[model samples]
Target: MKKLLCLLLAVATVLAMSVLPAMAEGAEINMFISSPEYADAVNELIAAYKEVAPDVTINYETTQNDYPTLLKTRINAGMTPDIFSTTSGKEIADYAEYSYNFAGSPAAEAMDPAVSAMMVYGDGEIHGFALKGNYFGMLYNKAIFEEVGIEFPRTLDAFEAACEKLSEAGYQPVTTGFAEWWVFKHVMQHFLDAASDDPAALVAAFQKGEAHFKDYPVLYDNFFRFIDLCVKYGDNKPLETDLAGEDAAFGAGKAAMMTGQGAWVEADVLAIDDALQIGFAGYPVTDDPAKSQIIGGSDQALRINKDSANLDAVMDFVNWWYTSDYGKAWFCDVAGVIPPITDAKVADMQIIQQGSELSATDGAAALSICYSSDSFNQAMGEAIQAYIGGTIDKDACCAQIEAKWVELDGAAQ
Candidate 1:
């Protein structure tokens, strides 16, 4: 009887050893992405994930400057992060060779359709997911507009008038972040939407060398006019103003309005003054108020490397981040971002709430900037900067931009 008991105990010990490895499988994931604005929130996410996945370790890294160039260098050196990020639409294809298409994965299924629409590769394969969906528009100080006694403008003429009124009342009318190259893409996309009923097709036409800025009155005239008004009533050092400068000016109540920024700035601006009333509206594109529609959808996409040594672990982390209760809540409660997944609660911030209301009431324009590669967008920004600095005439700017469209994007096609 004693011998029989020993045999049973040995069998139980073997079964326990087998179950322990299965339960405590360990892994490490390296996640490198842009938008360092969310670093703290992402770190919080990693901490929470540690609770659920005690054996998994995520090495998180991010940057705001020259992210694409650095990412390319890593890819070339065969040191790709387990997960990385790029712009969602056109760039998904640019990095498709290295990205995994987890089309039917839990995370992909939970994604908001508006965001997932931008992540598609060939034949409905989903190659990316977003940290947060986004909204691009003008952010203004509600207190300033109230003090000036004018409603937020919805037409180009009214916008100019509002600027004049605000200036007359001792407030800088606008804060343009002209120093950042990505700012041009944010500001130009609204004009691009107004220029064509189908902005994507129009952008594609320009890439194919079939469209010109001169051909669209909205692009050539009204958009430039709007830029001029912002400059005329803008910062004393408009060209020197980066996003931090813009935020400092606007947050200090010195500037009434901000451009080339969206929901992301709300937290920072409010951190300056929690009681500040913030207002959001579309850019004044033309004579028609309806043409001024808020633009919504994710522009940045986070992609998993298909060839990662720890692919299953990476997938599990993403799945939990997207679908779990704690993860869904973290987007709004912790990150204060527009949740990238459907049915998630919206952040209780002014820009996010207003952006949602405006998009619902007036409809949103497509995120046209996502249709072009960032390489082309960066070149376009430099040309516009030259125009702004008086080094190049408007016509010369257009010429340079058109040539670049063909030279950079056209070749890709």
Candidate 2:
């Protein structure tokens, strides 16, 4: 297999000159962003950044139109942008040997430490900076809670009993769009993490081939419970419903609850029902002491390319995102993103208020960032889609994950 990052020097090849004029009078800088999810927000930020540095041009692209392949080719050709995201968990570690520290770097200190920590490499150096922080917990229908005469579930048994009641009343217990592979996997991982004490450690063990889901009965049981619930309560022909449809189903009051990140609660769903009385609770733990609360990390991370032509500008933008109050407010207020910057607060957002309250009393689950290699996510997604579709057996689905783990290990070696 060809190595992905610029791990080994490639044969000399002609490369395109993609660099744009920099913020400085004579410098040329081109900023390339890799996530499709943040393309609009990033462009908006770019517009703001250019107010101070009009000469600099921001070159933006999501992970779209085969850009991943194009990016790999560019990196190999040594035409890599001045600043580019590593894109996925696996890619971040490929260059870990030469990672930089944003902590002491002028751009980082303006933000809160907790958000900063998430951006650092395992070796404690910051390669990425927090664009913003986010909170991820369960979004439950407050109206449903009132109608059912139940409070948000705190224990695993209570959670199931609530599901049972919801099912009895013909109310879908959970709104899931397994049809969309990423949404399916994200929720599954959230449930497992919400219930686990050491989510990161458990995933690490699985990554190293030291553990399997079956080895963790809690994981297996939850997996079964989740799928069973889906079978029981999902909309008719749910396997046909796409992720957006799932969101619509839940947001439009077609479903009672959704296991999703906090990011979607206010922006996506609330718009559909402004009167929607929704509450967020941390992932429930079957085993009491193991309960963890989660505020999902922002998908927005900032990275500079090893070959970047305008490192200063890229770093400047990253710093502004964390340090500048205006920047923080856009993400928190307009976008409803939680600021990782410690002191930043939004007094008005209802979901933030709800999440802050839940987390305040240890009601939140300390959820881990659910990440592995890009291939790992893809493989898990494939298996999940297959299982949900009933096109594969459970053992077969587990086996697929194990196989992919070995495949990634071998390639990395």
Q: How close is each model in CA RMSD to the real structure?
A: 8.7, 7.7
Residue-by-residue lDDT tens digits, candidate 2, 165-234 = 8878767877766665566445556655754567666667677777777876666776566666655666
Off by over 4 Å in 2: 1-26, 34-41, 54-67, 87-89, 95-101, 111-114, 191-196, 285-292, 363-371, 409-413
Say which candidate scores most in TM-score.
1
Shift of residue 404 alpha carbon in model 1, Å: 1.0
Residue-level lDDT for 356 in candidate 1: 88
> Candidate 1, 320: how far from true, in Å?
1.4
The candidate that wins on lDDT is 1
Backbone clashes per model, in order?
A: 0, 14
Model 1 off-target regions past 4 Å?
1-25
**Whole-structure CA lDDT of model 2:** 0.64
| TM-score, cand. 2 | 0.82
Residue 94 in candidate 1 has what lDDT?
89
